[model samples]
Target: MADIDMAELGPDRTLLLVDDDAPFVARLARAMEKRGFLPETAESVAAGKAVASSRPPAYAVVDLRLEDGNGLEVVEALRASRPACRIVVLTGYGAIATAVAAVKFGATDYLSKPADANDITNALLSRGEAPPPPENPMSADRVRWEHIQRVYELCDRNVSETARRLSMHRRTLQRILAKRSPK
Candidate 1:
């Protein structure tokens, strides 16, 4: 993705990035900083809420699930402190239900995980306009595989539980899990 025009980001460049994945968050913080944002980062919902309450950043990128609590709480806190704050919610386990809930809770946008810094920047700076289509969208099979993998991890790698939750035969789930992820 190309660099965004910082002039369009308005006068307030403060941005808060909250995610439990420390390395990923750190990397994103660096990337955002290079994009002309004054970035602050938090690794959990509590920290995010605290920052939002005390500082009230003008922009935010938050992971939907955290070790301590839901990211929506941070979004709510940011909105409460700065009503015009641009907040984007991200999750590996993205679903329509959660996306709707995030928006209702005050997020400006919701994106599936593995979103790059460019994607996030566009989301943050968008002025109620839909973004252009992805340059190379994931294939349907890859999407399904990724979703199944996420669910499988969430189920603690229990094949029976994962299969039961997905309503697939145990053997079939096992086969799918064993295969390499599709492109």
Candidate 2:
């Protein structure tokens, strides 16, 4: 595949990527490095903050959730350290409230989790009010299914706890969990 036009991000093109998913971050960092960014990675909010404080990067892709505290704190620190930094907030949680807060706190754009390298590159390069709606938007049912799955995982896949938290009947939650994800 062709690489992104990382030149648009300017020279040296340091990128801060903060996510707790080691495998995902490692893959994304390699892809971004191939695409022309010198990527700095952190698996937790503290590490991300330290990296940002030590040397503010021009671009940052931060996960909304981390092993310690929220990524929004990193976003805040980056904005303070380098007001011009372009920041994209990615989250599997995908809630409007946090998205709004991210923008309010200083994110250049907000992307849902599973945002691929291309999506992230585009978001990092494009300075805009918000990143474009995903090229292939998930269908409503599919989005709902994904949200349910995210909550399920966050709740440690406990049907009773997930149901109680989601305010759905345990059987209903179980059925949803048993079925395949929507397309």
Tens-place lDDT per residue, model 1, 108-158, is 999998899999998998888878999899999999999899989999999
Over 4 Å off, model 1: none
Q: Residue by residue across 22-117, what tens digits does model 2's lDDT show?
A: 999999999998888899999999999998899999999999989899999999999999999999999988879999999999999889887888
Worst lDDT run of 10 residues, candidate 2, spans 126-135
Model 1 residue 132 distance off true place after TM-score fit, in angstroms: 1.7
Alpha carbon lDDT of each predicted model: 0.94, 0.89
Q: Could you list the CA RMSD of all candidates, in the order they appear?
A: 1.3, 1.8
Clashes of each: 0, 0
Instruction: Give the CA lDDT, 0 to 100, for residue 31 in model 1.
Output: 92
TM-score of each: 0.94, 0.91
Q: Model 1 Cα RMSD, Å?
A: 1.3
